[model samples]
Target: MPASHSSYDSGDEPRPRHVAIIMDGNGRWARARGLPRVAGHRQGVEAVRRTIKAAGEAGVEVLTLYSFSSENWRRPRAEVDELMGLLRRYLKSEIADLHGRNIRFRMIGERDGLAADILTLIDEAERMTGSNDAMTLVLALNYGGRQDIARAARNIAESVHRGLLRPEAVDDELFSSYLSTAGLPDPDLLIRTSGEKRISNFLLWQCAYAEMVFIDKFWPDFDADDLAAAMDEFAGRERRFGSTANGR
Candidate 1:
């Protein structure tokens, strides 16, 4: 596991290298305002833009957003289609801007189920932003924690069966490399909006020791101040990471 950020003192509180967020409550926000759900999602996209700027300004090396989950397929087909359409539009509109900002763009989770046109756009965005080194923005689409783990396990088993990797050679690091987030640092902090406390099947393995901050505001209402507040909360906590506070 990576070193825990909770060990740092106040003055030495290093910015989290990677921050993952579960952007929640778009529908709830819309319902509360008597607006269509897609309106909230549209506003949520604006929040995404602001948060990206905030994270980059805060010196976070990587930002991962849980954009869509595998289980979200259970929603009404119209809603799903609307979300997909929004995603397509976002990619088309934002890729160039992201690349210009020197921000690397990446997507994780299953890709086979996405529409062919969406896949093509994703590929183009990734390729265009591949060389940028300032920071990375990772979107978890069609992702599930259990599914990710299962896929990694299957891949490892196949490698071993093919005589490419010995069973004894399989360890935590090797196993992690087989996961979707192979090259990215584990999240130092994870924030979930709308007061939800659970991880919701996002980054189960990678967030083994990440600090979590839950807020009452919906995704569309989240702003730079809220993000700063979360960071402040993170800065105040002490992370023991299974050891004594004295680091014994």
Candidate 2:
């Protein structure tokens, strides 16, 4: 276990402002129950709803979910189609509710490959919730960390070529501004369900210093308690950010 923050003053122990989750194991969860994988994916949506509510209650400012990864496109066409349909339905049904709750809905990923209708729905959701400040729910759809980085680099190169930016002005801060998550705080805590210890090409740049917690439960089975437990574990860590314990 890491050092606990309990000994510090309440003001000294700040809760994470941003959290990212890798929702995994949906297929396995369905297989275990002798059901179709889509069944687990559907249950995962419910889990997502539960998590959003839980996160709000827990004072999280931003919640980023790995809804669909770039590699997921390689899955069976039927499964991919089902996932896309789920995303479309979720956007249509939840955007209004999210706005009513004062939660901003944002999607981060490559948008060109998505269906035209899905893109339109995404645009509407973002426009509707753009002014909300209660919290942000960022869905990482068709996203990949490496690809994000590559895209940023490409953008920077193009800018430099066009004489819009000097090569000397390029740095970490400038580079990050080009990412899909620009203007958002980096995640302080990252949680991966299904007990997977790897990052799986998610948030490679943004989560550089995040405290990671891996849970054995499948994503569909995750609940508020699970999130609470992970947070409790996070509260026990001392983030030095490359500095020593003595703050040297």
- The candidate that wins on lDDT is 2
lDDT tens digits, residue span 1-248, model 1: 11232333233765678999999999999999999999999999999999998887777889999999999999999999999999999999999999999999999999979999999999999999999999999999999999999999999999999999999999989999999999999998999999989999999999998999999999999987787778778878887777888887
Residue pairs in collision within model 1: none
Q: Which TM-score value belongs to model 1?
A: 0.94
Off by over 4 Å in 2: 1-12
TM-score for all models, in order of appearance: 0.94, 0.94
Off by over 4 Å in 1: 1-12
Alpha-carbon RMSD of each model: 4.4, 3.4
Candidate 2 per-residue lDDT, tens place, 1-248, comes to 12342322243545788989999999999999999999999999999999998888777899999999999999999999999999999999999999999999999999878999999999999999999999999999999999999999999999999999999999999999999999999999999999889999899999999999999999999998887778877888999987899797
Global lDDT for candidate 1? 0.91
